[model samples]
Target: MIQDNIDTTTRQPIYPLLAAFAASCLLGTLATDIVYWWTADIIWADFSDWLVSAGVIVGWVTVIVALIEIFALRSARFRQRSRAYASAMVLALIVIALILATIDMLVHTRDAWTSVVPWGVILSAAVAALVLVTAYLSRITDAPAAIEVTG
Candidate 1:
């Protein structure tokens, strides 16, 4: 049964969001490959570059979401959009990329723990945790205020 609540009216759909992310990542990979192919003349030469491509996917999503909020939030069905959710997702992708970059950096050297990108991973983890907390808090705040209808 559908709860005919205003909050429900504006709630984000999970499956569609996941699909958007997947589609966007695929597009990002294709785009990165095409660009690299044109300039570097190498096809699928840099597989790890897909990590950065994932970041680009999330980045494009953030931009599109922001523009929607700026121009159409009032009119949109999902007016109560998860702004923090979007931001946190992008940050999470960056953190993943940072982690991968750290691993990549370690691959080129003998020492693993003594690299610089690991420090970046640590910092990115901290930031990602913070963003996740913020997203949680924002979701809480976006909830409609309770009212007491005392008779």
Candidate 2:
């Protein structure tokens, strides 16, 4: 039934938002790579450099997923599905951020950590978490009204 509701929406911006998020992440990562290449001797051969690269990739993926969820939540259709997706994305992003942060802390010193942790990654993760929490709470509040209307 919910699937049917989603298909009936006149317009959906979720896909485009997701695509934009992905593009932004990719651009950010590439920029990071280029900066690292120009400023330092690291050339993806070093283990720590590789780890930072991997973290950037994963962080971008998580942010893109979260943006998709946020777009879904704003959509007139598929509110429930949107909330679910947002919740899932939030959980996934948190886990990924924690893992990446841990790896960075253990592998790099304070100075290195400051250089390795991309601001884009942190911003995206934070936005995703905030959007997810807001959407989830709204969905929970609306559930009773939906039930009452249907019953």
Candidate 3:
């Protein structure tokens, strides 16, 4: 049974915002890769380089923030087994995405056309999928607010 007047306290998580930004920048590289492939444009490759670089940097920052959140709020956030499992899954996905992003960044360092055609695009797509999954999992895992009851 749920109470209509259930009292709860909410604290916003900062890592989700950072994750979204990193995901967007990383995912955007896929688009640029496609455009570069289609138009054979050097500019699009350049865009992919910058976007992937930024995405990788922010991805690392996101990892740091998540670690801080886990340690700082361990008692509040991971009390439930399922919540702990979900958080771990999210962290794993982020790490995987970071790895792909790093490889993609390296790929982007090559010549403009070769950099983005096959390998870069492939890595970008992989990272994009992981980021999407991470975002979705994080959303479902979010507790939103903690309920408190008083006698």
Instruction: Give the top-scoring candidate (TM-score).
Output: 3
- Tell me the whole-model lDDT of each prediction, alpha carbons only: 0.39, 0.42, 0.79
Q: Tens digit of lDDT per residue, candidate 2, span 124-144?
A: 344344434533543564421
Candidate 1: the clashing residue pairs are none
lDDT of each residue in 1-151, candidate 3, tens digit only:
1342332223445776787788889999999999999999799999999999999999899888767666665545476788778777778888999998999999999997889989999999999999887777777776211212111
CA deviation > 4 Å runs, candidate 2: 1-45, 72-78, 81-89, 92-151
Candidate 1, residue 150: CA error in Å?
Answer: 31
Q: Give the residue spans of candidate 1 off by over 4 A.
A: 1-53, 73-116, 143-151
Using TM-score as the measure, name the better of candidate 1 and candidate 2.
Answer: 1
Query: What 10-residue stretch in candidate 2 is worst by lDDT?
Result: 142-151
**How many residue pairs collide in each prediction?**
0, 0, 0
Residue-level lDDT tens digits of model 1 in 1-151? 3444554445443322432453344334434344444455343324324533454345455545544543444323224366444544544554454354344334323232322233423433343344345345434544211111111
Per-prediction TM-score to the true structure, in the order listed: 0.34, 0.28, 0.84
TM-score of 2: 0.28
